[model samples]
Target chain A: MERKLQERKVNNIVCRCEEVTEQEIRDAIRKFNLTTVDEVKRLTRAGMGLCQGRTCGSLMEKILSEEINKKVSELLPLKKRPPVRPIKIKLLAKKERESE
Target chain B: MNKTADVTVVGGGVIGCSIAYYLAKKGADVIVVEKNKGPSFGASGTNQGACPLQLFEPPVLELARQSLKLYKNLSEEIGYDIEYDNVGALVCSVDEKQYSDMKKHVEKKKKQGINVRLIEREELLKLEPTLGENVVVGVEEWESCGVNPFKVNYGFACAARRLGARFLFSTEVGKIEKDKDKVTSVATDKGKIITNFLVNAAGAWSPQIGKMLGLVIPVKPRRGQIIVTEPTPLNKRWRCISDADYLLTTAFDLKATEVSKDKRIKLGVAGVYLQESTGNWTIGSSRDFADYNTNVTMQTIRYIAKRAIKFIPKLKDVSCIRTFAGLRPFCYVDGLPILSKVDNPQNFVIATGHAGEGITLAPITGKLISELIVENKTSLPIDAFSFSRFKNAYLQNLG
Candidate 1:
């Protein structure tokens, strides 16, 4: 049924890295009156996972815009940090090569 | 928004929110104006959340003690769970020279009645089994703790709201109107707020606010980078840990003798490992005068990772989830916060320049600032932290 499908969508995992559900994100937005993606990320840990919100960044912005009745262009994306992708600490800790 | 209030607090970071909450609890009308969308968008939220008591000295140690007591009951008092973890801290030393230095530091702290002791490698390894073999000794402080930085900031903002404090988020303060020697109103992009007292708790931006009043608030932005790792069971039982060099790098501003030839020391990279309640280890910290830039460099990230691996070898296998940077409001004079009431601005208060200890000192700073405003005197001796101490320095800088 369409109604059952809609219910499943609410439980859909938005951020796979953190296992954060769409409903959980909605609840946090409503509770904290969060307007920005960074604020919601800090409160619900949506984008604070191994991938660092790279996959779910756009989806979160879309959801926020729809919930707040604002256009997608009006919403700011989640703040990006370094290490665009997850990197092993051993690789990062490896000493740099010396020049001749 | 209310057109008038007894106090107008600039900046909605943890310091401002805590001051607002304390003032509101005392039934003072308060308004906090923040340019950001919410609180803790700065260093307060980005920190590793460690409150190690072994790093404090003299007057600051007294404030840290009082703040620790407040943090124990803060969650209940604010009606919010701040995720406060009182697991204590370990300041590890990797060499005999550093161990001797730590022993002297411990003796000084013990004389000050601090609950700390120097432990050999045997006991150090017993406390943190995952620590690297290079760890020589550790100074264990039983009273240190960690808290969720975001929650602590948000908790204070919410509690202040509940106590009838108004927060004007996304509002930029354009000008501060003063009548001769007293603050009259604060003009923002949204509107002007008529207020009797104004508290400049803007952290790194306190200097700009001071510039508006023709005063030099000696606060500069010191950039620090931190890395967060994926959830690992290896750090499940570990308490907050740091290298003894971290104190020299942060508190003492790297004035100590050159201990290592590693370039990481130049970047102020020190090993500080803290496992959040979520099982993810937050490793940090670096210090540099990068103005207002908060970008985490690849080289700095690599240095921090190497430093972390030097402390906890198991961390070398863990995957880094993210890396971010924050700008600490470092005070140039004596490396202490400037919490005081200014005579020039009569009703203006300066509560900024906390450097790396903002989160650890928030509660006491708020209580003391509120006491100065409401009761006209503080419960603790704050004359040492007054603006008058920097009067000569300010005059010299002007000349």
Candidate 2:
């Protein structure tokens, strides 16, 4: 049973609101060295969805804290920039001459 | 490839987008270069989005009155749902002194062709039962409207694009390249934009853009913190309600204490609250010179929340979803925006510093700027908003 627990593939869905899986979070953490919930969010879409982290904020924090071996309080969230919500790339792009 | 434009509008806020839309609609090749990824990324996107006809001085009153009519059909004209909700706003007062002042304001606005009425406490209660018992009188502006700020901004950008206007997002203007006295082109992070006309609509950063051209634009960032409350089923149809004290604090008026003649009540929070169509209440705000800081402090948020609860007791039970801040492009000179052609740089036009009134005054401002660009004269009386108003102060400060 302990070996099976170790072999488990971290496929559990963490942020049900954003449909982000624990495997995706771990992969994002490994890929980007994410040490905060907001970092994981930017990388894996963990808490960037409808709930705005209401459902899985703490879970992401817990995973980050455990992965980094640091207090959750010490890990600050990602700095927010403009276009806070996802905007369409096409809408933001320059207009085409053909369309004109 | 070098992009060429007939007019280059800096900043992609509602003002810039509005200007671009009108300019393009008039057959001018326009390009709006925004540092942010999208329009309304500044104060335009973050404001209460109230289109009130009251509480404005003469030209602003006339401009807002016109803009209200423009907003009524802007969504239809632009083929976008700017979500213009035509709900009346109530300017409430809880004290006897406030009531008399509100009466004067209503009378003054009424004479300006605004549909305003002074409602006493009994009728105010009938209109807004959620208002606290301390309400004495209220001024109702039936023509006031609410809108989604993001949609108003992006809608203008999209409509402008549809009309052959080009928008360059995530592109910051680095320098204004000029030849002798005329603005030849605007150099951006991407490339140089060669243009015949240049408009500085950079909002809080308008001064920075002006500095690139050796011009003095006296606009600074006035920090305003607003709190959002989780949606409640109650107060869904509640019109916008606020304490009359907002007029004083909105400007950080030094004479507010002297004018009010009341020293007991602190003036920072005035119970300015508005509900959005999203069911959340976007309660606002505080006006302070934070020098471009948009950080939402716990102190200001707590102050805002406390005052909001005082005005509407039911908000006490509602939890806050989030609190954010936006820097209003406050003009220090006469508290009015600078909208005029630069005397030295003949082709450079400035349309900025609308401050909190940006959302309300965008359309008329756009039309006036376009008129200045195309016809060299606007129908609106803009003698008060000229660049020359700051000339003496500009020289004195330079000295």
Candidate 3:
């Protein structure tokens, strides 16, 4: 378990909500050469946290733009995930099943 | 008696007070007006008060980096103890695939002259022992930290006052009366505040304030919900979760992530809550476009709880005493803070559209506003942030 923490330290926690880390972010950035925050979120889950990257977006965008060498203004916010709030999976499934 | 100050700053939040304190320190007779009874009432007052620079935009990151230096000396400078901690921040991830992706981010951040780096799981445990077993990676920035924002904003206001900046609370600037191209007076709910210069640092209310001056600002409101927890000792050194997507939260380019976002199950960078010296763990946030309204919803609070629960097991037992929401001056059209001299208008500067990162950009924005007003020079480039950049987009979309 201690080893897990150590290994995770170097990895990027893309989604603090899920404890997603840096290595995930790097893979997503390179896998797509991500040009925006939304892509990073979709591919790596960086901004998918409790705060929804509200606190992290600026840093994320800064890190993304600086590393990607793209203009900061070019990045777009990740497509906000639905349920914009947490809903019970049972309720979610009921809604989806009903819609289906 | 000519009581008019050299500068009359509107909306006394962290941004306003930070600007006012600096101006007052520089020997300017400045006056700050507030709709609240005192400082630190809005988002600045309500924030989890994390001063970590890791959760910021690039331009804002640089500004935050600069402000951080001042933050270290803030207690001494302001003669008040601002609860700031530079314990470091981290963004953690799981899975081999996630780890590899973080590698690319590290390489990119390196190129930009930032100190962010990736650590393996073994090192992650060394940094924080309480993380769940599922945790595999953490992008760490030892340079980041947190602050007691209530005190920071309060200190800025009090210090600014002590330094000769005046405060007029419960006063909202309803109109910015301009003559030809220059602002002549700031008309408030109280009356006309005769002044020579105007600084529109009104947070979520900036767009309306800008329009009152007949100047255009692309600022809009986006609401965020936050939650605070009961005291515990699981604190780590101020680490923040990068949440890979948060690194590019504003990337509009289709090729960036390239997936049609309208279909994603979730979007946001998540967790990094360590304990403060007082033994409290402050965690947060959920995003909603509920528009300009600040209300705490059960759904948002539960979302925050589940999000935190997934990462830190200790959170499962902690008590969440409160949940609240604050409005960020969101500018969705273009990813830029609208800053430009009220074109052709002398001594009128428009500074808002900070969106979620207003706190991160507060110090530097204040510096830049001061530079533009006092020396007519900017500490950093202001072209991208020009309030006028949206005019073209606004006009183009008109068709």
Q: Using lDDT, give the best candidate's number.
A: 1
List of clashing residue pairs for candidate 1: none
For all candidates, state DockQ relative to the true structure.
0.77, 0.03, 0.02
For model 3, residues B1-399, the per-residue Cα lDDT tens digits are 334778899878888998888888778889898887556557776566665565565655576788777777888878877767776767776546677767877776677666887788887776676676667777777776677675677678778888888888778877777788778887777767778788888877887777776666776666666665555674454344434444543222223333435322132214346566666565666545576677776555555565566566666766554455777776767645766675756777777777666665666777778787878878777877776677788888896
Report the C-alpha displacement of residue B113, candidate 1, in angstroms: 1.7
Best candidate according to TM-score: 1
DockQ of 2: 0.03
Given candidate 3, what's the lDDT at residue B12? 85
The regions of model 2 sitting more than 4 angstroms off are A1-50, A53-100, B234-237, B252-268, B394-399
Fnat of candidate 2, please? 0.00
TM-score quality measure for candidate 3: 0.75
Q: Please provide, for model 1 over B93-141, each residue's C-alpha lDDT reduced to its tens digit, 9 standing for 90 to 100.
A: 7877886688888889889898787889987677678988988988877
Could you tell me which residue pairs clash in candidate 2? none
- Candidate 3, DockQ to 2 decimals? 0.02
By TM-score rank, best first, the candidates go: 1, 2, 3
Candidate 2, A41-60: lDDT as tens digits? 64465764545676788888
Model 2 lDDT on a 0 to 1 scale = 0.77
Local error of candidate 1 at residue B357 (angstroms): 0.7
* Residue B173 lDDT in candidate 2: 91
Measured by DockQ, the strongest candidate is 1
